[model samples]
Target chain A: MTRHRAAATLMPLMSLALAGLLVVAVLDLPPQSGLAEPVAGAMDRAGVDHPVTAVLLNFRAYDTFLELAVLLLAVLAVWSLGRRDPIPARPVQGPVLHGTLRHLIPVAVVTGGYLVWVGSSDSGGAFQGGAVLGAAGVMLMLSRPRELPMLPAPLQRLGLALGVCVFLAVGTAGLLAGHGFMGYPPDWAYPLILGIELVAALSIALTLVLLFLGGRHGH
Target chain B: MATDPVNLQIYLACGALLFVMGVHALVVRRHLLLKILAINIMGSGIFMVLLGVAAGGEGGVDPVPHALVITGIVVALSATAVALVLMLRVKAATGLARLPRSGPED
Candidate 1:
């Protein structure tokens, strides 16, 4: 009991001390220009027009690829846990919501596609688009009629693996062509990055929806 | 435009406080859900700090940190999903949504 009390008391003090140290560290950091200049200098050579896209897809493609793998791994872990219990039927169907969804889902799909397309030159990208698509899928899952039609098992699996597989294939191709692994040739950067983003966006959308489902799809 | 130094410091301080608060919550709270939430708060704090640092640079905002934070967000989402499922399994197996009181709270 006394030990518990001591630990409880000490935790706040420790946290506070840590916070103070962090503030001091932040204050001590010298003001300096970040990697903006270097990134800018390399922009033309980068496949994409947007600085963020350039960094994400070109300069640091490995990190993004691993991120896709992490998403896939997460779904695998969830599926291994057990089957997802079916959603209980809602007694009261709100017609308004169903009506709205009827008009909204197609728009959401178009918006997601636009986001992915605009990503090369703007603030939107694969993740943003995929998230939007995932939201639409979730809406469908939640509000659709009880006998919701799920994608066939194989197709679902394909969608889930699409991102990482495509990314790996592209990276390996780049390596075989004398560009480093995950690197783009000077001329092929744009098309290659866009292709990766499109497939990655599809995979990301599927992964998010599966994560929402929370377990294995079928029996 | 470069962030004003004073504002940048303030943002950094806020981020630091958020991270500390998250750590405090994660340690003090016993509920599995709260712990997961606390972890997310900590992630948000780190994102804030990274963006603050990105903004304080000389010529332009750093794209590297922006890219990093985007990756972090997606990773966090996946992690949270896995954690939530694990929590559900724990609940199903043990019939408790919170951790057993084997620590300070006990």
Candidate 2:
């Protein structure tokens, strides 16, 4: 009881001290009006075209490609590292939670698909959707831990390669048409952007799910 | 209210807070999963900071930062997967969820 009291007393004091620091930090900020003009000028130079798509495919296509490569490497690392390890048999935890997740998994999967589909125009996208799908896999694992399927090595490799493959294909096609890498012909911009984003979202989602599943050899 | 640079400042501050918290988590937590969460939080902070920096003018938020953030988000998840896999392997080997401690040698 004494220990509980001591912790309770200390928590509030710590919180109050933190709150005071936050207030001071906020108060010290410079006034807002002085920063407007320079920022606006920078924005003007950036060109107000389809900024999001342009940023992804043109301005920083190199970064996007590398990012895809990183996911591929991660999948490979996990696969190689886990190859020699013995697989632990997962024990069944509870029936109630398992039953609940059985229904929840499909819902999560459908919602994730919807998010990826609508990502181009809406607040959600492939990343969010993929995370949701990964979470559903997590839920399934937690409930029916032993039932999770092992991912085949070839399929896992394919999943990791998918993102990079799509990216390079589009980029090379663009180059063949007399544009630089990833520089789509003006008429083909929207279609190509949608295609790339869709593939990226799916590949990324699967890679993440595989990662969460601990790169096991089955599922 | 009309667009203001102050909003950008607020976003920057939020990002800073997220980063500091992530650093603190990295220092204090031994659990690998929690560490992954901390890393994600830090990535989120970076994204927020970039977006805030780009939101300079009256026009819509800069697409460059948005694109960068999206890429960052993907990379973060990729890193998270690799980390999680490592953690799982460690768990399988040691039967513990926490990272191995460095011994006092030197």
Candidate 3:
């Protein structure tokens, strides 16, 4: 009891001291507004108008590739930790839930696609699109309990691996062509990025739902 | 695309406060879930700082940091999933949400 109490006091003091240092450092940051123009040439090389998408898909594609790999690693770790959990007992669904499910899935799919497309020109991207799709899956899981058992195991695995496999394949091809890993040729950049993003969104959505499902192969 | 520097500073300050709060929570909380939550909050604070710093140019916010933050958010989500599963495993083994006593010190 005494140890806990002592920690409570000390932790706040340490936090405050750290915060003071952070404030001093943050205060020294000279604010620069507008798009940092330095990266414009790199953006042009990326072949898309949206600077953020260009950065993610071209300027620094390797980071994103590794990020996908890391996500897969996390899921693998989770799976290794235990046997498949039995699906939870079905909740009694109200009429309202049924109605919402009827409408929500279609909206989520359309919006997810829209986000994927918008990512190239404006805001929204694979992650956001995938989130919407994952929500739809979760809602479907909730509304249709029987489908849980019916979810095929192999399909889920494919969804989980699709993003990384596709990305790596493209990157390796770039290397084979002497363009280096994750390099987008001046002409191939647009199609390659959009195609990769579409697959990535699918994989991301599946991985999220798989995370929710938990255990090996989400069985 | 020019933005008020004062507003930007406010966001950075908020991020700093969040970081400290997350640190405090991580230290003070014994529950595994709360610790994971504090870590997530800490990640959010860092993302906010990145955004604040990157938003300083006239051509809209720099896309590199924006992409980085998006990637960070996804990575964080997976990490939380792993943490939650670990917590579940720990609970199953020990029947406790908080850590078990390491020895007879108590």
Candidate 4:
């Protein structure tokens, strides 16, 4: 008991010390001009009108590509663990949930699409759109008392792999054209970024739903 | 940037404090779920710091950091999903939601 109490106290003390150091660090940080100016200067060359979108899809495509891979890797890891256990009990569905979902899913789908389309010039983007679509998928899953049907195995694999595959293909095409890897030709940047975002959003939505489902549906 | 310096300072302080609290919870809590949540809190703190700094710069908010934080958020979500599944597997295998305590003191 004494040891436990001692550990508890020691842990808080350590945390406090760490907190103080972090505050000091924050206070000590040097202020300077930021990359905003540089990004703005490059905006004409960048495909997207929104600075954040340009940075994400053009200036730093590599990061976004790797992020997609990470999402895919996560689902792969989950699938490897085991088949998911079924929900313990099914609560009888109320008409309210059914009615809500009936109205909600179509709205979510349209909103998600609009977000992806507007992302090049506004706050909405692939990730935000993907999240909305994913939430709709989760709602659909919850609404169904029975096991939700899985996509055919091949199609499922293709959907899961779509984002990375399309991204790599585009990058490879860029490489072949001598714009360097992940680079789009000056005129082609807008369309390519938009296309990639669309596919990526679709893949992200699928990945999130699969993650929520918690394991692979056994073949 | 047009952002207020005082507000920036407050945000940075809050971020640092949040990170500290997350560390504290991670250490003191034994539930695997709480540990996962604490780690997420830590990530949120880092995001807050990034945004605060992004706003502190002159001219405009830095788009690079905004992009980085978005990437970070997606990565964090992916990580959390995997961690939750792993926790469920652990619970099934060990019959405990908390990890087995192991220490010289124990």
True contacts kept of each: 0.85, 0.34, 0.68, 0.79
> Could you give the DockQ of candidate 2?
0.28
Q: lDDT of all the models against the reference?
A: 0.90, 0.67, 0.82, 0.88
lDDT of 2 at A133: 79
What residue runs in model 1 are displaced by over 4 Å at the alpha carbon?
A88-91, A216-219, B102-106
Ranked by lDDT, the better of candidates 1 and 4 is 1
lDDT (Cα, 0-100) at A1 in candidate 3: 72
Please compute the TM-score of chain B alone for each predicted structure, in the order given. 0.94, 0.85, 0.90, 0.93
DockQ of 1: 0.77
lDDT of 4 by residue, A71-126 (tens): 99999998888655774354577887778878999999999999999999999899
State which docking tier applies to candidate 3. medium
Provide the TM-score for each candidate, comma-separated. Answer: 0.94, 0.69, 0.92, 0.95
TM-score, predicted candidate 3 vs. hidden true structure: 0.92
lDDT of 2 by residue, B17-100 (tens): 776677566645678888889888878877876776557535456556677788777777767767777777778789987877
Ranking the candidates on DockQ from highest down gives: 1, 4, 3, 2
Which digits, one per residue and each the tens of the lDDT, describe model 1 over residues B1-106?
Answer: 8888899999999998999999999988999999999999999999999999999888889999999999999999999999999999999889988997777542
**Candidate scoring better on TM-score of 3 and 4:** 4
- DockQ of candidate 4 relative to the true structure: 0.66
DockQ of each: 0.77, 0.28, 0.56, 0.66
Who is ahead in lDDT, 1 or 2? 1
DockQ: the better of candidates 1 and 3: 1
- In angstroms, give how far residue A193 of model 1 lies from its true place: 1.2
